[model samples]
Each structure stands twice: as structure tokens, then as C-alpha cells.
Target: MAGAVTTVTTLSNEARPKHLTEPRPVRYLLIAVALLFIGIVVVLPMLTVLLEAFRKGWSAYIEALKDPDAMAALRLTLITALIAVPLNTIFGVAAAWAITKFKFRGKNLLVTLIDLPFAVSPVISGLVYILLFGAQGFFGPWLMDHDMKIVFATPGIVLATMFVTFPFVARELLPLMEAQGVQDEEAAVSLGSKGWRTFFKVTLPNIKWGLLYGIILCNARAMGEFGAVSVVSGHIRGETNTLPLHIEILYNEYQYTSSFAVASLLMLLAIITLVIKGLIEGKLARSRHGQ
Candidate 1:
């Protein structure tokens, strides 16, 4: 009996993957390689942006950011995020709830459409809006007749941003909502709770962290989006240019310090987003474990 038990133990150990049983040296080497890669890809570029932004002096860096065009770009970027993030968050939550908590016709189609933005390139996404709204395009005459402009205007910029960042929140929540299942929602319904009550009480608490995570990612993408916004913005300097487009204009005009200074703002935003995302992820992990 003891020999049989020993054989079972040996077999179980052997069934584990070799990588999981690697030597300490190999483990340390892998960790070192991962750290090196992150340093090269992420940390180095951030440091470079900061270093170059203030290369001249603190005064120059401050002056660069205080430029009228730069301030305009900053405000435009903020307005875009303020409009885009909340709208996408609402859409994402609705899409996630519909796809996860209920079953209906065209479910697969709904999911595919949710993923459509990710499958398409940013530049192509911009061009699609232009084709629909450009002065020479399909709705051009109708829009002109109505004296309404959608392309190469603020509306165009917002639309492009919405398209590019559409997938982030939904994609984040889909798998999470799926894993939580529908039992809790069903219980709430059986207990005489209304739809919105159940959602606000039971559903929201369960998925809040995942929702926040998705919102952060969505906001980050919206603010940093360049290709799509650039194509539709007409780069009208202070009028339509967002921060990324403004940075490009500055760089093109050989204003390296100013460009880096503007770039630094984006870099700071990215860093803050990453930090918040990490904290939210930690909270999410704890909540899941508690469940």
C-alpha cells in the first residue's frame, strides 16, 4: 500500500509541466529577461520623453506648454475625452449586459460588431467616416443643403475617436460578465426586484471593478488616439487639433522641445492610467477571490 501511494505521488509530480519545475537559476534568468524587455520597450521611451521635454530648462518647458495652440489642443483633447468616455461606458455596459445576462436572436452578430473596431485599422476607420460625410462623398450634398458640417470639424473628431475606442470597455467586461453567470440576477428578479433595481443593486456591485477597468482603458485610447483623429481633424491648428495632432505639427515645424513637452502630457496621462488600472485590477482580483 505504501509503495502504491509513493508511485501515485511520483506520477502526480511528473504530470506537472517541466517549466513549472524549473531550477532557480532558470527562473531568475526568465525574470531578468522580462525586466530587461520592459525596461527597453516601456521605461526607456518614457524617460526619453521626460528628459527631452525639459532639456532646455524648466522655463522653456513651461513656456512650451503655455503656448496658445498647445492650450487649445489640450482643451480639445479634454472635451473629446469627456464626451467619448461616458458615452462608450454606457454603451459598453449595455452591450455587456445584453450579451451576458440574456439570450436572444443575433447574439453572435452583436458580439462580432462589438469587436469590429479592433479588427479594422484606425486610418481606415477615419476614412470610412469621411466617405460618409466628406463634401465630395455620399451625404455631402445633403449635409451642405442643410448647412451642416460633420467632416473635418469637431463632430468628425468626436466620431473618429468614438469608433477607435469602442471596443475597449465592452471587450473588458464581456468575459467578466460571462464568468459571473446569471444566477444572481435571476434571484433578484424572483425576489420582486425591478430590472433597474436589480442592475443597480446586484449587477453593478458585481461588475463595478471590471467596468472601471474598462473605462480607464477606453479613456486612455480616446485621449491618445492619433491616426483616426488626424485624418478627420483637418489639422486646423488651434481650431481642431488635439494634443497628438498638435504635437505632430510642432515636430514638423522643428519645435522639438515644444513637441516633447506636449508629448510629456500624454506620457503622464498614460502613467496615471496604468497606475489606476493596476490598483483596480488588484481590487478586482480580491473581489473575485472573495466570491
Candidate 2:
């Protein structure tokens, strides 16, 4: 019995290291599979669009670039993004501050409502705007009487984009703020720092990266927004058209090359956003490490 026990113990010890080492093959296999899927689904499609954009050479590119309607769409998209992202960022910060820094009744419900856009269909959101602002819809008659327009106009587009991007900044900042706790704020208060000063000097520095990340995401979504904007935009050519809408128009008109070109432009913007976000996150990480 003693001899058998000794043999089993020796075998168990020998097998343990091999068991740990053998699992590495499974890990590598999973990583390779993930990469393969990403390449096939995302990388390949992006490459295809890039190639198609340049398919017609520099002259076509220049022509598309010079198209007044295309320029207008680009301008409108930028303008909407400029307006919407800042507004959303402000709202997000306020929402995050309220929800994370204070405890109140129905707090969870409020947070859930703020995040409702994530689950609500963009089409439905657009329709709701239309119902509220359309000429024949609920408040539409009053708005018309007051000579105000919301649907089928720039303001409508901005509002729709705002609705869609509303939760981004808050979602990004909420957890970060919660994790940071109110200790710093309390310390600042104890030191007699004013609210705004404490927020700018203490709170802002800690979560700036996360805030910026959310802003970038908001801007990207605002720029690329299609479904909701389309529903309310009325596709009024240079007047109300955005880049994504313009791309759709081009595609429908069988301007395949131009569609791809515009798509490539959007893709480039997305890549730039991602790069900026990565840089911000890296800086944040390094800052934390240094601290």
C-alpha cells in the first residue's frame, strides 16, 4: 500500500505541469479563430471600400470632392456633429454626476431611461420626432403657426442625432466616477475649495480621458447616423442631406464608385476617432501608472 501511494503521488506531480502547459494550445487556437473572424468580417470589407474609392483614380475622386451637394452634405454632417456632441457631452456629464454622486428616489429608473436609446430602434426614435414636429402631427400645427420647423430640417437632424448619442458620455463616465468615489471631492471640500474649482482641478483630471472617449464615440455615431436622420431629413439634397444620406442617395442612383468613396471617407473618420481614443486612453493609463 505504501509503495502504491508513493507511485501515485509521483505521477500526479509529473502530470500537473504538463496539464498547465497543454492548455496553451487551446488558447492559441481561440486567438487565431477570433483573428480570422475579424479579418473576414471587418478588415476585408474595409479594404474593399478603400480599394473601390480609388478605383476611378484621382480625377473621379476630385470630381466627387468638388460636387457641391456632396460638400453640403459634409458640411451639414460636421455642423450637426458639432452641435449634438457638445450638447450630449454636457448632458451626459450632468446625468453622470447626478446619478453617481447623489442617491435619490427612482435613480435606477432614471439611468435606465437615459440608456433607453440603446435599446429603442432608431427608426422609432425618428418617428417619434416626426410625430411631435411634423406639420400634421401633435405639436406640428402649433409649431407651424409659430413659423417653426423641426422635422425635415437641420434642427430635426441634430435633435435625432442627440437622442441617439445621449447615453454615450454618461455611460462612459458613470462607472469611472463611481469607482473613483467621492473621497477626493470630500477632501477638496474639507480644504475649502469651491465647487467649480474642485471639479475642474480634481474631478476633471481624473475622468477627462473617459469623457473624451465618450465624446469621440458620440461624434462618430452622430456623423455616421443614418436611419433616424433619414426618416426625418426628407433627403432634401444639399439642404437637409447628411453624409450618410448622401451616400445612400448615390448608391440608389447607381453611383457605386462615389458611394464607396464617401463610405471610405466615413471609415477614415472612424479610424481617426479610434486612434484619438486610443491615445487618450494610453495617456490616462500612463498617468495612473505615474501616480
Top model number, lDDT: 1
- TM-score per prediction, in order, is 0.90, 0.89
Pairs of residues clashing in candidate 1: none
The TM-score that candidate 2 achieves is: 0.89
Candidate RMSDs in Å, in order, are: 8.4, 10.3
Model 1, 77-161: lDDT tens digits are 9999999999999999999999998889999898887888887888987999999999988999999999998878899999999
Which residue ranges in model 2 land beyond 4 Å of their true spot?
A: 1-18, 21-31, 285-291
lDDT of 2 by residue, 1-291 (tens): 111111101113444566567587787899899999999999999999888888999789778867899999999999999999999999988888888888899998997888788887889878989999998899999999999999999999999999888888888888778877788888998999999999899989988887887888889999999999999999999999999999999999999888888888899999998788767766656545544
lDDT of 2 at 2: 13
Clashing residue pairs for model 2 = none
State the TM-score for model 1.
Answer: 0.90
